[model samples]
Structures are given as structure tokens and as C-alpha cells.
Target chain A: MVFENKNSHWIDPYTHKFKESFKDINLLDKKKEYWRFASPSIWYDKFTLKKFQETRSSQSIKFDVTNYNFLRFNDGILDTETLRNFINKNKNVEICSFESIFLKKDHWSSLKFCQAQLNAEKSYERPLALFNGFNAKDGVFIKFKKGVKKDLHIIYEGNNKKNCCIRNLFDFEENSEIKVYEHFYGNSKYNVVSELFVADNSKFEHYKIINQDISETVIYHFFGNCKKNSKVKTVNFSFTDTPVRNEINLYLEGTNCDATVASMGFGKKESSICDNTVFISHQEESCKSRQIIKNALKSGAKAIFQGKIFVASKAQKTDGYQMSNGLILTDDCEFLVKPELEIYADDVVCSHGSISGTLNDDHLFYLRSRGIPLKEAQKKLIQAFFSEILDEVSDDNIVYYIQNQISEILTL
Target chain B: MFEIKDLHVNISEVEKKIINGINLKINPGEVHAIMGPNGSGKSTLSYTLSGKEGYEIEKGDIELDGESILDDEPDERAAKGIFLAFQYPIEIPGVGNLSFIRTALNSQRKFNGKDELNPAEFLKILREKADYLNVDMEMLKRPLNVGFSGGEKKRNEILQMALLEPRFCILDETDSGLDVDAMKQVSKGVNSLRSEDRSFLIITHYQRLLDYIKPDFVHIMAKGKIIKTGGPELALEVEDQGYTHLLN
Candidate 1:
């Protein structure tokens, strides 16, 4: 049964659209190219659309929000007191709930942007994202004024909920800059979608850290639109024990736009699966796009990466690069990669590569001969394998936190 | 005191014997040079001593200070004061050179139940030693042996030898790819570390390296065994007469 948001007059129309789309969408079709390696039945069979009762108190969730503008959510429910405090402190930026923004006459442009994003032509490709939109009764909407700079920390804590879905929208005006850190915690299955609009000459950096229990499953969709001379960069660090699929789609709509996406994941358990699907479309001239995805899988674990760069005929002088690598620790692990480049422009430079292999024996011997034990040496090499993607992250605090999480995952 | 007693070894993968009935000994403060023609198993002996995998010991024992070390791992042997400077240093693309050396030093220290040095202390020691070997700060900051010139890699190896301060050092054709200046610098670094309690095993094909770091005993090796043992004059004999006379 689809979730019905009868209370919100503005969101009911999208919920109805979701129900209509669900009739034709088949998530478990093995014939579908995108769904071939990852069968949705693994999670779809156990997913419950009915809202879960909040079984755990908010006091159980713990976080450190020092040196960050903070927001917290528990089982898809926001902490209004923290939101109020955040709003009182930051007066220049507009932060409000989706329903309130839709009702406000002065914020009609923001509402229109949200409606257009919901009705995007490519929305049908991702059925789970539409499901999230239908069930997400209330979500945060943030808009930055021109030339503003800030760092925001958003945390989601799940307490054994059967299913939790949330949506978020970010708007960066011209010449503005912002860095967002999204963290997911606890044992609830999650369906999340975030849309970003980057205006001319703006910079937006998004970092996501997913560390959750082995029994949970997470499906995330990220969409971005970049205008002239805009920059959009995102780094994802996933250290989860269960299945996780992160889908990212970025469109370069204006000239001189730059978009970069990088992800690092480690799958340790036999049931672990980490999937990343990314598409970058260059519709304008002189744009650049880069994607780097790396994963280290242990015995019986699996990793999948399907990335593509699409350049339109008029998008001349486009430079696109993509590289995907997997380090298989044992013979039983699997790494499936399909890196594609679709170029219609004659004057474009695009390249893609995929490689999967075990650790080099000579490198291992060198370290062991130097007095580093075998296990420590292997750990160091594994850390080094992910160092390239980690180097792309700009914040030191986040890097340290991610490194700690990676170490913990490795030990497990 | 390091001793190799009638050692016999083979390449484990192909089961081809490389070291056949070799015996050698080096007391405190003695520098031994093993010179031989190609395929003489000098490198095999060095690798066998360093506990590298794939070199199976079929017979004989390798003892350090009167204790057999056949069962120890490479790292365990390293903690017992054994160091081998490779002819071709492996390139690790992401591990920093300085950090690699520091980790090695600390690993040995931990194995020996000693306290490890902090970064500041390790850096101070490394800087002092690296300067002597002509290894600059930039080379140490880069990935270990990645994109380094032959001389720079050899110098980096010597710097590690200097930092680790092993009691029994094995130079496995360390001067093969080095120029005259680099050879001199490496020789000087090795000579500086020689003392009453330390020993050296220098494996080389040319006598030019021996001219820089003089050896106390020179052994001519051929066909997986040492054919003859003499003083430094034996190296000059091989350089002038070649190994045909020694083999016959």
C-alpha cells in the first residue's frame, strides 16, 4: 500500500502521481539493465510502506555537533527545537519545512522549483525515489542567499523502524558556498532523496557518511543541476554491513560547469553489498565531469559500479573522466563494473576505466620484510588504496571521522 | 656473529635448487663481500637469510648469535637485527617513504618489547640520517620508491638501513644501478654504521663498489656455491682474470 499524505494539501498531488507511476514501474525485473546485478526483491519484499511507531526515545541518539550548524532527525521525524534554534541563529539563510514553504505566498519560486523537480522527466527511472517522495510527509528546505558561506551537519538516527523515508532540497544562489555533511545512524531501513540546485558561480560540497547495522538496507538518490560556472562536488563514504545503493545524477545545464563525484566503500561480511550508479550529462559547452569509485571487498562480499558520462552534440570541449577500481581480498568476492562513455560531441575528451584485482605480492613482501607484520601491512595497503578518494575531501574533521569508521569496518 | 652452516635452498615454486651446500660465517665487526658471475645465487642466499617467502630451506641452519632462525617470519627476523637492502626496491604508490621507515622501525621496536618513537623523534632521526645519504625531504614525503631515480632509490634504501640500525646488514647488489657519486654516498653510509658489534654481507658483481667500502673477506661464488675465499685481493683477481679460473 502506498503512503497517503492526506494532511498536506500541497504534497497530496505528488503522492497521487507516485501511485500512478508505481503501477507501471517494475523494480524486480531482471531483464532491466540497471537492475540486473542488484535484485530489489531482497529489500522490497521486507519493506513496509506503513509508517512505523516511534519505539525509541530521542534521548537515545547521541551526536557531537561542535563547530557545525546542526539538525537532527529521528525515524524520519525532525527535532523542531533544534530547527528553531538553528533558524534563530542564522537569519540570512531561509530554512523551513516543505509544507510551510509551499503555503507561504512569498516563497512561490521555491515551491515552483520543488514542483518541477518532482515532475522531472527522469523521475520514472528511479521508482524508489518516487516512493520516498510519496512517504516523506515533511522535509527540510534550505535556500542560501547570494554570497553566503556556511557548513551544515544533518544527522538521521533510526531506532529499529521497519521503514523510514525522507527528502531534502538545497538551493545555492549565485556566488554562494556551502558544505553539507549528512550522516546516517542506527538499524532502520531508509529511503532518501536529495535535490540540489547550484546557481551561477556557486560552490556546493556534499559529504555523506553511512555507517549502519548489518540488517538494514538503504536506498539513496541524489540529483543536482549546475548553472554557468557552478561547481558541485560530492564524496560518499559507505561502511555498511548490509545492502546499500546510492544513485547520483547530475546535469550540467550551463557552460563552464564542473561536477565531481567520488565514493569509497568497504564490504566485509558475506551478505554485504555496495552499489553505486552515477550518470553525468553535459548539455552545455565547455563543461567538466569526473567520477572516481573504489571499493574493497572481503570474502563472499559483492560490489557493483555502473557509471556513464553522456555528452550532447552541442556540448563541445567537454572533458569527462571516470575510473572504478575494486580490491578483492579473497577469491570468492565479486566486483561487477560497467563504465560507459556516450559522446556525441566531436571535440570532447572522455575516458573511462575499470579494474579489479588482488593485492600485489611484491608490495606485501616489501612491507613484511621491513618488520611490519602481515596483517598491519595489509591494512596499510588497504588504507592507501582509498587514500586517493579521501584526499579529495576538504574538511579535516570529516576525514578523521571517516578514517576512524573505515578502521572499525576493516577490523570487523 | 652470523653464520650460514651448509645451507641448501630451492625456489619453492619450481623446486629448482639455488643455494646448494653453502657455508659462511662473519664475526663481530667483519665485512664480507660475495662476488660472483651472473646466476651464482648470491641474491638467493641474501633472500634466504632475510626469510623471504618462496625460498624453501632444504638443509642446514642460519644462526644469528648462536640461535637458529629458520622458523621466524621476515618481520621477526628483522626485529632480530637483520636487514636486507634490495637491488630493485619495490614501489608502493601510496605509502610515504618516511612513514614506511618509521613504521618499520616501530614494528621492530614493538616486537622487541621496546617503546616506539613518536613522530617528532622519528622525524628528527630520519632527517639526520637521510641527509647523510643525500635523500631530501621531498623524496621522503613522496610515495615509497615511486618514480625515484635509481640513485634516489638506493639512497633511500641506505637511509632505511641507517634508521633501522640492524646489527647484520645484507646489501644485495645495492650498487648495481648507482652512479659513482651515489655509490660513494651509499658506501659512506654503510661504512658509518660499521662497528664492533655490527657485521656486513655485501653482494656484488663489480669490484668498483668494493673499492669504496673495503671488505675484510672476499668470497668468489659460482654455480650456487662459493668456489674460493680470500682477502680483498680475490675481488681484484676476479675483476682482472674473470671467474673462469676460479670455477675451474
Candidate 2:
């Protein structure tokens, strides 16, 4: 169901642990909030406390709710009376902006329940100024299901003069898959931190296409987890996210786990940067991980890629590869890639490679000799260069779409 | 239809010249064989005629059809009906042979105010032409010259020549990499496209090709300058004496 608030649409609050099994239980008070932007492990605290109190009848620590709370409500910032009206509309459901809650009334919520819980919500305290302004009022909560897949596309556009935090709880179950193509396109701009969580044997393919059209700097934080035999692919296609940062930390807690990180970005004019920092743990044997990043910079634009891979002592027989290739279109177009691999297991196979270069003159002339004009010749060469990676795109149609984009970048 | 008068070329960035005081003329429907020893600037002359960059033309005039074509770019020269089948044809990835031919043909046609051919129509016409040359459709679809054997690349060059049908075609060591059968087949293709308004300038160090496509006139180039000009029988004499008698 589509949520059209008729006014505003922010992230909805969800309060469910995203997985069935838990290694730790939280001993915190229900009213207290953890540190701002807790690490991946602190998430266990949020999950344990909510699962303990929410299920009244079934004392079982395991529950799912997003599979049922697939209902749509108005999203976005609202005035005092408007928020009051929204809460009144969902009076029968446990509607709290700060806490992760599960309403067993919609299929969407039920889908989340199958993963681990309905929603694992994080509460954000609003500033005194946001009470009158449009900051806290615009936040929203969306709960997804276990088997069904949906696209959450957004253009984070318009003028943003204040700070606002957006939260979403996407819970999945075993033997389920979902793809979320989220785009963070802003015209005026604001900072956003979005988090996605997946359960064991469940897969989440997330694509964050960020475009920077803002006068102010924007930072986007992403936190995700992958369970045993689960697949998670995250892509960062950003055009100068003026300071876009994607922080992905995944835990392969089960044997035979697989995860991949692929990213492509372009920076133009006076230092546009993206820090793709990732930490994938090979906690079990027979896990595999691959990371690839391609960057092309122009007009003195700057880019940075910092990637980390870890093979735990017990992660024997694991396989991993990390690579980053970049092209500096102009002499001043600066690009730097830092890739690291930390292995504690002696039986693992891991490698990393990086390369940067300009266009080839001989290749250019060979095309010209065949009578292709200059621009068209570059298109062919560049297409051939990027095709190595683009051919890996799962969809043939998407390959053509990206080919056209490369053509567009060349034409400009 | 091609003439080079007082031609002087420098292959390096310095003022030192490669071709000095060269003068030659090639008429329509005539096969001009340029037999030169190694380091005689045979490749330089071909590239200069095709307007390759970094080669400084110190002095001279090159005329095609009575018009001075010295200032033209390579593609422009190509558009003006000039084709060069290189000794070592460059490989261009992602450019199919058929599309490359069609693009070259259409560019020339557009230069002369003609319409372009669509892919389907171009493919039909190309298939017919390739059949005449005994070429395959697979070669047309693959990237130009990529993964092609030496003889296959030469055949591909000839196929490109047939597709473009330029007014003045230069064969730069086209016979070097071909076997007897390939040389015969390529000669047959060229002979089929022979017309009164088109000319061939075949550069070779050996005279074996003269047996297939008999040249009407043969010019011997020594140290970048033409030292002897004769009929097809001169090729026979060069094969007999191996340029030793010509130098003497």
C-alpha cells in the first residue's frame, strides 16, 4: 500500500527484532534511548527489550509483526494538531514515533514479523525548535513483509534548513527475498541516516542512488546485517553526494554465508566525496564476500573509497575479493581508494586490487582511422571500458539504461 | 587521379625529414606498384596521404582528382574517397565491422549529400558484398580486427574496402600477411570492383602480387623518393634483380 499523507511523508517507526535467533538480551529501561546511532551490536539491546514486553500471551522471545502491519498511514512532518489527528486515526494500533512497535493488522507488518519481529524502531528526540518547525513532524514508519518485495524510491528534495533523522525498520524471514531501490535525490538538501536489517536465510538487495543538488552538505549513513547463507548487495550510485557516506556493517554469523558490495559514483567540480566504509565479518566457515567499486572523477572533483574485510579465526575456508578501479577524466580530477583486508584464518583466500588511468591515445586513433568521429569514438572506448562491469548487471534492460547514461555523460 | 609533387615528410618532432624530394603521379584505372626497400618511408607516405597526426609535411602538394588535398584530416580524407588498408590494421573493441563499414560509408555519403543506410538495409547490402568477397557475417558482427588471424584481418581490410568503394585506395603491405589463396581471393575482389574512376596504389617489397593483379605502371622507391617508373615488366625485373640492379 502507498502512504500518501496529503501533506508530508517521513520514515515510519518500527519496533521488531529483525531475526528469529538472538545471542544477547538487553537489560535497559524501556524509557531510555541508546547512544546516538548505536553500533550493529547495540541493536541487540533494542530487539531484546521490545520482544520481552510486546508479546503478552506468548512468552516466546521470537515474534514477527511487519508481515501483518502492511497498513499505510500519512507520512511526513505535521503540526501539533496534525500529528494528534494521525495518532487518533490509528488509535487501536500501538502508534509511537520513538519506539519500534508491531501492529498485527496488515500484511506488510506480518511480512516483517516473519523475519524476526514486526519492526525494530529507534526513537529520535526532537529539538525544541523542531516542535514548531517541520522536522519531527515529517518522520514516518514503514513495515515490510517476508516473501513480498517492494521498492522504496524517494527524492529527498526541497529546502531543509534544520536537522531531521529518518528511521525505517525492514524485517525479513528465512527463505524470503526483497529488493529495495532507494534513491536519495535532494534539491535543497538535508542529512539522513537510514538503516536496513535482514534475518537469517533472508536476502535484501538494496540500491541507494544518491544525487547531490544541494547547496549544503549531505551525509547518508547505512547500516545493514546479513545472516547465514543470505545475500546482500548494496550499490552507491551517487553524483557528488556532497558528503555522502554509506556505512555498511554486515555479520555473517552462519556457515555458507554470501554477501557482495558493488558501488559506482561520479564526482564533479570542487570536491564532491563519498566514503564507502564497510565491515563484513566472516564469523563462520564457508562464507564468501566480494567488493567492487568504480569511480570516475572530473572537474577537480574528489572521491574516496575506504573498504574493510574481516575473516574471523573460525571463518576457515572463506573466500573474498576487493577491487576498486578509477579514471581521472581531467588532470585535476582527484581519486583515492583505500581497501583493507584483515584475516585471522589461515585457510582463507582473500585479495585486493586497484588501478587508475586516463584514456588511451592509440585506441582513439584506431577508431578515428576507421572513420568514427571523435566523440563517438570515445563513446565506444568508454563503453568498452565500463562494459566489463556493466555486463554483470542482472538485468539486460538496466545495462542498456546505464549504457545510455554513459553516453549522456560523454555527450555532456 | 592522385599526384604528389616535391613531397617532403618528417617522421620525427625534429626537422629531420623521412621522405625528400618525392614526385609521383597515379592515374585512374591504373595499379601503381611502389616497391621500396625497408626504411624507404613507404608506410610514412601512406600515413601522410591519409593525414595521420604527428607526421609533419615539411613541403609539397598532394592532389586527388586535380584538387590539392593536403590540409584534410584522416577521416576527412577518408570521406573524400580515400581508403588505406594498413599492413598492421589496428584493433578497435566494441566496434562491429559491419557497423564500422556502414558508418564510414554513411559519413562519406553524408559528406557528398547522400542518405544513410539503416542497420537492416545496411546488413542486406553488406551480406551481398561479403558474399562476393567470400567473407562471413560473423566477421561483420565481431569487433573490428579483434581475434582475427593475420590473413583474416587482411581479408577484413579488403572487405572494408569493398564496402566503402572509395575513389582512391592504398594497399600498404596488404600482401605481407596473406597466403597464396588469400592473395588470389583478395585480388579477385579488387578486380571485381575495378572501375575507370577508381585507382589502386599497392605498396609492397615483393612482386608475387603482380602476377595476380597486374599493375599498369610500377615505380621503384629508394630512400623515400621514386627512382624508377616502368610497366608491369618492371616488377618482373625487380623480382629478378632484387633492387640490387636498380640501386646500381
Candidate 3:
């Protein structure tokens, strides 16, 4: 049975709308350009939406999330005790579950706040996004007041036979700044959709990590809107060999908006895949966007990167740049990259580049001639290849965490 | 001791002969110089000894310390105490110079069952040798051979040679692109490393380098064969009259 918010008044309307959008749509359409390298059949054939209940068991894998403001979704059910304790201790920003926030009818301002924020248009063109919009049972809603600063953490674990759909909406008012770190991993299949709204003069930084093992699959979709003088930066790391499909879209609706998207992917296991697709639209004047992606694929692994930038006719003085580099460790590994730009403005600058090659023979010989073994030499070069993107992360905590995680994957 | 016996090699792709029936021997503490014109197989012999790929060995063997090393990989040959200073050092981006040297040194030591040096100890040794070669400290921090001038590259090669301290060293055109003063500094660094248990094979096109490093035997090679062998005077003879006079 699909998840239903029976007791909550505010979210009941969206649930009905989600069910309406889910019917009469084909989820396995292969003709779509967005599904060129990835076939929806592979996902549909491998996973099912089975009803699962939380078992109250400890997490099999653990990461230190104590120091940061943390929340956990164990087997698709929110740990209410943990969430309540965290909320009581840190009341700087209003944080609560979507159910708790919408259950009461007398919270006039709260309902109005969420009604305005959560009612942002949901895209029906994508089947997975439509499914997630309707079936998502649990998620967190964060509301940041004007000129507020906050740090948030969200964790999603798909344990056992559970299939969970999560939806998150972040609303940042004018001059507010916020940073969020999201971690997704586990054995169950998960479909996640996030929508962010950055008001004028505000800033948002989103760092997401997908680190599932070979037995899991994650479908992630993100859509964001930036207003006048607002900025948005996204840094994603794909460390899982399991097939991960990532789609990101950002729209600059106001003047002087800026956006940056960067990602690092390492395909370490057999038949591992990381597919990333991004779209950025510039609708106003004096906006800028930058994209940098790098991938290192070992034997039997594949990586795909597709990115496009669109500049409207009135969006003059736009500056956009994109670069993608791939390193294939063996002949068996595969890398595919497609970077494009569409600009209608005459006074704009846009550039895109894609490069893929195996390790340089000269570089290998130089290392080996100095007495380094061949395997060690290749490892060192692979590490160097990834450092180009990893070094760009500005947050110390995230950088340290990512560095350790990357070392673990590469060394194995 | 290092010995080469009736060595014949050909370029792998074209199957053209480069080193034909070459024989030479060098005892410990002795320095031998091979002077040849271009296409005379001086660099080919050096590459063959260092086990570079694409050079097919058709006949004969090379022995170090009484055992043949012809079947070893390039890195294995390096671990067996063979060092080749290339005429043209390659530039490897994203690898620090000092870090590369340290890895090389420890790899060889590990093969020989010797304890590896920690970073502090490694830095101490590198600084001393680099200072002796007049190498700037900043150069060690840059990527290997990237943006290095000709003189700086040669000096860096010498610095590596000093740190490795191999049993057999081959300097293939080490003085090709250096000015007189830079040549002297390189020769001085090389001269300081001479000892009773180490051997040197210096290849050059002129006698100017031998004026400082003083080889015990000088061999003239032409058309893939060593034509003559004599004392230091043979180098002077080639420098004065050129290889055409020696050919006749």
C-alpha cells in the first residue's frame, strides 16, 4: 500500500495530488534523452515497493555524526526521540517532521509558512520524481527566518527489504545562510527528491554523499531556485559501485545569481555505474554558473556525465564554464561525457570541455624506474587524479570526511 | 663488477640493428667513457642495460655482481643496483620531486631487506645531496621535471643519482645541454660519489666532460660497434679531429 498521511491536514492535499500524478504515466520510457545511457527497466526490474517496518536494530555501519546537528531515518521511519532531542537542544531554526508540523490546525503562521514553501510546482514530466512526490512517507522540513544562520545534517538508511521515498524542502528567507550535509546509503532501494528555495540575498550550500554497497541502488533528483543576489553551491561525491542516477536542475530567476556544481566519482567494483545529469538555466542578467566533474574508473566500471547550460536572451553578462575529466584505469573500464551550452544572449561567455584517457605510459615508467611497483604507481596516479576535485571542497569537516572515505575506496 | 658480453639488440618495431656485437667490462672504482656521434647506439646501449621496453635483445647478456640481469624488469634492474640518467628526463605532473625520490629510495632498500628511512631521515639526506649539487630547495617542492630549465634538470638528475647511490651508474649524455660552469658543478657532484665499490659509465659526444671526470678507458663507437679503446688521450683525439678522422 502507498504511504498515506491520514492524520495530517496540511500534507493531505499534496498526498492526493501525488496519487493523481502517479496514475496513467509510463515509468519505463526509454526514448527520453534524459534516459539515454540509463534504462529505467534496469531499475524497475531490480527493485519493488514493498511495505517494510522498522526492526529497532542498530545500524550495521556507523559514521560519527555526533558533533553535527543530526537526524536519522532508520528503515524509512524517522527516529522521533533523536529528532525531538536535537530539536529541543537547538531551537535556532524551526525543525520538525512533515507529519508533526502539518498535524495541528491552529498553527496558523506555521501552516501558512509551509503552505507557501511546500507548494512550489512539482515537475510531472519525470516518472521517478512523480513517484517520489506521491509516495514519500517521511521527511524533514527546515525553515530559516530572515538573517538566520544554521547547519543541518540528514541521514537516510535503507535497511533490508524496505523501499522508501523521501522528500525534503528547504526554505531560506532573505539574507539567511545555511549549510546541509546529506548522507544516503544502505541495502534497500531509495528514491529521494529535494527542492530548495533561496530567497534574495541568501546563500545555500548542499553536500550530498552516496556510499551504498554493490547490492543497493539510489535514484536522486534535485531542483533549486535562486533569487536576486542569491548564491547556491552543490558538491556531491559518488563513492558507491551500485548504480546511482543523479539529476540536478537549478534556475536563476533573479539578477546577480550564482551557482556552482561539482562532483567526484570513483567506480571501484565490477559493473559499477555512476550517472550524473545536470541542467542550469539563466533567466536574468549578470548570473554565473560553473561545473567541474572528474571520474576515475577501475576495471569493469563505467561513469557517465551529462551537463547543459541555457542562457535566455535577456540574461546578458552571463558567465558559464564546464569541464569534465575521466581516467580509465584499464581497457575494460568505460567513461562517457557530454557537455553542451545554449546561449541566446550576445554578451555572454560560455565554454565546455570533456576529456577521457588511460594512464600516461610515460608517467608510469617514470614512477616504476624509480623502484616503485607498477600497482603502487597506478594507485598514486589515481589519487592525484581525484585530488583535483577533492581539493576544491571548502568545508574542513566535509573535506576531512571525504578524504578518509576516498582513501578507503581507492586503497581497497 | 659489471660485464657485457657480445650484446646485440634491435629496435622492436622496425627490427633494425642498433647495438651490434658490443663487448665491454668495468671493474669497481673504474670510470669508462663511451664517445660516439649520433646514431652510433650510445643511448641504445644505455637503454638496453636499464631494461627499457621496445629494445629487443637478440644475443648475449649483462651481469652485475656475477649474476645475469637480462631477464629482469626495469624496476627490478633498478633494485639490483643499476641507474640510468636519461639524456632527456620526462616531466610528470602532480608528483612532487622529493616525494618521488623518497619512494624510489625506499623501494630499492625494501627489495634489499634494508630498513626504510622515515620522512625526516629522508629529507636530511636529500638536503645534503641537493645542496652539494647546488640545487635549490624550492625545486624539490615542484612537480617532477615540470618547468625545470635544462641546467636545473641535469642537476636534479645528478641529485637523484647521488641519493640512490647505485652500484653501477650510466650517465647518458649528462653534459649535452649544460654550459661550462653548470657542467663543472655536475661533474663535481658526480666526482664526490666515486668510491671503491661503485662503477661509472659516462657517455658523451666531446672530451670536455672527461676533462673533469677523468675516465680510465675511452671507447670510440661508430655504426653500432665500438671501434677503438685507449686512455683519456682517445677522447682528446676525437675532440680535436672529429669522428670522421677516426672512421678512416
TM-score of 2: 0.70
Lowest-scoring 10 consecutive residues by lDDT in candidate 2 chain A? A54-63
Candidate 3 residue-wise lDDT, A246-327, digit = tens: 7788888899999998888888766577888888888899999998888888878888888988898999999998999888
Give per-model TM-scores. Answer: 0.93, 0.70, 0.85
Report the C-alpha lDDT of model 1 over B1-248, residue by residue, as the tens digit.
99999999999999899999999999989999999999999999999999999999999999999999999999899889999999999888878787789999999999989999999999899888877777789988998999999988988888888888899999999998888988898899888889999999999998899999999999999889988999999999989998898888
Candidate 2 regions off by >4 Å?
A: A1-179, A184-208, A211-224, A227-236, A239-260, A274-292, A308-323, A341-351, B13-16, B94-103, B138-145, B175-189, B208-214, B232-248
Residue-wise lDDT of candidate 2 within A1-412, one digit each (tens)?
1222322222232211211122132323343232222222222222122221111111111112123222221222222343354455432222333222222234343333212111112212212111112122233344344554443333343333333334444555665666655444333233344445566676777665554343334445454555677777776665542545565556676788788887777665553655565567778899888888777777766666767788889999999988887877789876666678889999989999988887677676656665666666666776666655564456454455556556655665
**Which is the winner by TM-score between candidate 1 and candidate 3?**
1
Residue pairs with backbone atoms closer than 3 Å in model 3 (clashes): none
Candidate 1's displacement at residue A111, Å, is 5.6
Interface RMSD (Cα, Å) for model 3: 1.3
Report the candidate with higher DockQ, 2 versus 3: 3
Docking class of 1: medium
Interface root-mean-square deviation for each candidate? Answer: 0.9, 2.0, 1.3
- CA lDDT, candidate 2, residue B108: 72
Top candidate by TM-score = 1
Report the number of the highest-lDDT candidate. Answer: 1
Choose the strongest candidate by DockQ: 1
